[model samples]
Target: MIRIMERIALDDDELHEDFMRSSGAGGQNVNKVETAVQLRFDVRGSPNLPEGVRGRLERLAGRRLTKDGVLVLTAQRFRTQERNRADALERLVEMVREAAVPPPPPRRPTRPTLGSKKRRLEGKRIRGDVKAMRGRVEGD
Candidate 1:
């Protein structure tokens, strides 16, 4: 099981990994070896995640989240399959850990202070005056 937080733990079966040939650098090894790791996690169907965390994970996944609600992460930075696999898993854990945190409270709407509003208007007027002075002098 992978521990995301004190309350959240994911089973190993929750994660699915696939190996494919990695692109770039390695030359002959790149052509012959399947080093890239693709990690897929079912955010919607997972029994391990809380409903709120699941929703946040889905949002955080963004384009990585598929239409079927699977979060797909590909790791190809490393040359070895083991490193790439570990990288993918580590990324998944980080993502889940992020989702575990509660969102901040919604901000309350606030009106501009009278002093600030006056200052803003004053600044605008000053800017207009400066721009007006830049125009060609009518009597020059």
Candidate 2:
């Protein structure tokens, strides 16, 4: 099970992982063993994610999500296949959790209070006076 958040958990079946060659630095063992993991998740068909969250994840994934609606991630940083697999799953879960939380609604616009407006005008006036003082005291 992939636990995303307190309430969100994805079943192992929902995740697809395949072993492949890693491009990163490694010895001959790297060439022989498929240590890289490619993980794909179908956000559009997942029963685990909420409708809104799935939509958001699809959008957040951008190019990662294919036209068929699969979020694809390649994990080749780790040396071992298991490690690479775990890394991919961890990253996917984290991203899902992040996308699960919706942004807070925007606050309504407000006009500056009368006092604040007055204070701002006064500050502008003071600045203008200070700048005016910088002018040359030429004409007698």
Scored by lDDT, the top model is: 1
Q: How would you encode candidate 2's per-residue C-alpha lDDT over 38-132 as one tens digit per residue?
A: 99998998998998899888888989989999999999987889888889988898889889899899999999999999999999999999998
**1-140 per-residue lDDT for model 1 (tens digits):** 88878998999998999999999899899999999999999999999989999999999999999999999999999999999999999999999999889989999999999999999999999999999899776885
Error of 2 at 65 (Å): 0.8
Give the root-mean-square deviation of each candidate in angstroms. 3.9, 1.9
Worst 10 residues of 2 by lDDT: 22-31
Clash totals in order: 0, 0
Candidates' lDDT values, in order? 0.94, 0.89
In TM-score terms, candidate 1 sits at 0.77
TM-score of candidate 2 against the unseen true structure:
0.89
